[model samples]
Target: MRLAWFSWLVRNFGGYGFSDGPLRAAIGAGAVLLTAFLVRITLHRHRPAAVAAAGLTCALGFGWLAFH
Candidate 1:
């Protein structure tokens, strides 16, 4: 799963109209890091229901991204 996510990142780097590869990669990495940090905090502080909701939200987000 981790490898696939990294592969997707690499394949989609500079996909948002950014011409510089390194800058795009950095932005992507930062976004992933920020998401991880937020999820970690949510898991630590929130209830299981909240965690499940977060996971579901992420899945729906990825599904939207995949299909559209």
Candidate 2:
């Protein structure tokens, strides 16, 4: 699952552009990172698992709905 998703991300957003897939993983990654930063700033604590989950969800959602 992880490898497939990784491949999809690289193949879509790396250099494909609109030929096959949308290059929106960059946007997704940025949004996810921004959300993580916001969470860290508001929570005042560092929990890697929680931040990872949030980022993963954001990335997946963006990929499925927006990036696809």
Candidate 3:
């Protein structure tokens, strides 16, 4: 499960270790920043196609995360 994987990650690389809340907040912030950067660049060049592709990618990513 995702929680198991996250725990493994924390154990391996979290140094003194981290509480889940702060770690999750940091990761979520990073994801949002990365998504915004990618969308800004792609949207400027590809317009409608970029938006569609981004939407599809997000849906697929969420589905995979939820099911796998």
Q: Which window of 10 residues has the lowest lDDT sum in candidate 2?
A: 14-23
Model 1 alpha-carbon drift over 4 Å, by segment = 8-46
Please list the residue runs of candidate 2 whose C-alpha ends up more than 4 Å from where it truly belongs after superposition: 1-22, 45-68
Clashing pairs in 3: none
Residue 4 C-alpha lDDT in model 1: 100
lDDT of 1 at 49: 61
Candidate 3 differs from the real structure by a C-alpha RMSD in angstroms, to one decimal, of: 9.1
Query: Best by TM-score, which number?
Result: 3
lDDT of each: 0.58, 0.60, 0.59
Per-residue lDDT of candidate 1, residues 1-68 (tens digit): 99998998668754633335566545654564566457756777667766776666666544443343
Model 2 earns a TM-score of: 0.38
RMSD of 1: 5.2
Candidate 3, residues 1-68, lDDT tens digits: the string is: 99999887667543422334666646654565577558756787778877776666666554433343
| Candidate 2 backbone collisions, by pair | none
> Where's the lowest-lDDT run of ten residues in candidate 1?
59-68
Q: Estimate candidate 1's alpha-carbon lDDT, on a 0 to 1 scale.
A: 0.58
Candidate 3 residues lying further than 4 Å off, grouped into runs, are 1-40
Q: Pairs clashing in candidate 1?
A: none
